[model samples]
Target: MTHLFDPLTLRGVTFRNRIGVAPMCQYSAAEDARPTEWHLAHLLQRSLGGAGLVCVEATGVLPEGRITPTCLGLWNDAQESSHARLAQAIARGGAVPGIQLAHAGRKASRRPTWQRGPAEPGWEIVGPSAAAFGDYATPHALTPEEIEALPKAFADSARRAVRAGYGFVELHGAHGYLLHQFLSPLSNMRNDAWGGDFAGRSRLVLDTSDAIRAVIPDQMPLFVRLSHTDWVAGGWDTEETVALSRLLKAKGVDLISVTSGGLDHRQKIDLVPLYQVPGAEAVRQGAEIPVAAVGLITTPEEAQAVVAEGRADMVLLARAVLRNPYWPAQAAIALGRPEALVPPQYDRGWNDWGKLPVELAVAEPMPAL
Candidate 1:
């Protein structure tokens, strides 16, 4: 049985614990689409708080891939340098640095939640089909030529991530992003070789993974985040997600982070704790692959149960960690592990009931090809 406190290794990267900080969009980048001080501060604090891995938010691979105007990007040299700083900061703060590369598809060009009104003009929004996502901006249908070129765009971003020193790379194929748009029948209505059947629809993500895997070091782990179900009838479902996970595993994906809904506005998701754990377990068993469970995992006990019971290999915390940056340290005390989280400077506050070895070191992965 895997304990939540046990270190989890994927390829050459070793997380200090099963607890990971899920990427949350800061939406604080400037017009240049580079990391701002906010990103470094936010991510570093979480890393210092004792999370094993700190994944940067969904970043645009191309300028137009951004969901909002201020979202981060990795396409340019400046952005790559900025990301390098963020990645190194994470490592120094005691966590493996990770990044999620994404394209928002029809969902691009929308305003951030903090912002209001229609999206400002002069941005191109593209998707698998020319359809719009609910009341969002209508998108131009990507030509097959453009679609074929997308894998390279993603691969190029992966290459930059390698140089930027990210230990883990995740393709954001969920939450109605561009890749999810292709997977869901509701979004991808094309009749070409790029669409229609399951194989055709899944081509982009697979190709992107293959391209990245081929270029990155053999030791670096790659993860894929998938919306296990669209939660609407006839949309992408858990059955297909399981099937896809199998294929992704065969294609060199190390883990599948499972969550559901977010494909369509009509999606009807049940509100319950651990509602998505079953889906994660299904993919893990059905595909015989390592899986990360995310959703309403709020407490340390809940997180420990998910791992100890073999439902998921990891539990990613977003809102919980945001609520308390040192949740991992607190969890350590609750779970009877040593108070190995706080740094020497803050050691005086924590009770010294026991001691557990927690190394703030990341395994050295080979340089990118």
Candidate 2:
């Protein structure tokens, strides 16, 4: 049985352990959608905290794709140059640098959440259909020609990710993003080649995976984050997610990082610990694909069992890590596997970790560009 601290390798890249810091947006980018200093300090600390991987936030693949005007982006050379520094800093801190390529669709161009009440849309948004996510502005339905162009846009971002020194790349198909807008029946009402059936709905993501895999070296893994369910009746569900995962595996995709329910404001989720693991487990077993379980998995025991019981291949954390950036090392100590807290950092509290196999830093993987 694989434990939480066990190393996991996908394609040719190796993670020091199975605990990854889930990509959580800081919404602190510059006006041009470039990552600011906050993005660097925020992620590099998680790397040093002993996370196996630290994924960058949901970055816009195009200007209009941003969730907020301040969200990170990857469409240009300057952005790539800026991100290279982030990737290198995370690598030096002993974690694999990964990025989530995203387009927020109808959810784009809102005020940052910290701004609180009644955030209005700053720009026109696009979606699989004109259906809006509750009170957000109704989006323009993308034409067939626009649909055909998106895969290359994602592919171009993947190419830039390689050039930026990201060792892992994930397509953000979850949490009511552009790809999720196409997958869920409640949001995507199109009858054209881009919508209607499962095959049609899946085309954008499949084409995107194909495009991204074509450019990135075989050594790097491509992950897709899937919203396991839309949580409303007659919406996207586990069965469809399983089928999609199988096809994704055949397309040379490495893993599914399972999350759920951001496509609709009408979604009725019963929030609790491990609420979404079953979804991840279903995708892993039914599809016979590796999956990373996310959503409310907040405890060490819960995270350990997810991997050890063969329920999921990896356990990703968000709020848990945000509350404690060194949750990985702390979990190691709690599990009586205290070696992860070693190297006797000059920090006073960590000195009593007793004896441990001081880990040498992992060498940076060759840049794919």
Candidate 3:
């Protein structure tokens, strides 16, 4: 059984442990989608904090695909070089660097979440149809020509990502983004060939993944984040997701990162610990490939149980790591072991736990650090 601290190898990349940092958008990029100094520092800190793998945020393939003014981009050479610098910094901290290429569709061009606004901005959000993302924005419908151009954008970004030294690439196909918008019937109301059937609705994601794989090297691992269920009636469901996962596996994807319930603004989800674990298990069993589970997984014992019982191949942490960048280091102690994933700077303090129980160390002084 694979434990939380076990190593995992995919393609030519080997992770030191199964714990990975989820790609959470920093919203600290330049207006033109270039990576700033803040982006480099944030990722480097997490890597140093002891994650086996660090995935950067959802980066846009085009200017209009950005979620906010400060999202990263890989559509140009300058952006590619900037990302390469970020990758170098992450490597220096002893973690494998990864990137998530994304297109927000109707969810694009919004003010950062820190601004706390309710209305959509003036930018034109484009999607498969002229539908809004639950009153978020009015998207412009794409013609056949425009729809064909979107895959080229994805391929161009993938080529740049290889040049940027990313060890892995994840296609952002979940959370009601551009590809998810096409997948969910509730959001995609197009009656053309791009809609009205499972296979037709899935065309964009399949074609986009194919185009991306064409540009990236076979040695680099490729994955996709999928919304297993839309959590709404008459919307995309688990059956469709299972079918899609098998198809994606045939398209040469290595794993599926299972996430759920972002297809609508009025989504009523049951956010419980390991609520998404079953989805990951479903994909793992149905697709017969590795799957990463995320969502309210805060404890080491719980994460260990999930992996040990064959529920998931790995665990992804976003907000948990934000609350404690050293969560992995603490997790080792929680499981009654301490190893060298900790930086040498913290080695002296490792002995300071004198006579305290491991549970006390995990409960009392972890998040405060």
**Could you give candidate 3's per-residue lDDT for residues 157-215 as a string of tens digits?**
98898888888999999999999999998987878877878988999999999998888
TM-score of each: 0.94, 0.94, 0.93
What lDDT does model 1 reach?
0.89
User: What is the clash count for each candidate, in the order shown?
Assistant: 0, 0, 0
Supply the TM-score for candidate 1. 0.94
Tell me model 3's lDDT, rounded to 2 decimals: 0.85
Model 2 clashes, total count: 0
**C-alpha lDDT of all candidate models, in order:** 0.89, 0.89, 0.85
Residue-by-residue lDDT tens digits, candidate 2, 156-256: 99999999999999999999999999988898999988889999999898999999999999999999999999999999999999999999999999999
Candidate 2 TM-score, true structure as reference: 0.94
Global local distance difference test of model 2: 0.89
Residue 193 CA displacement from its true place in model 2, Å: 0.6
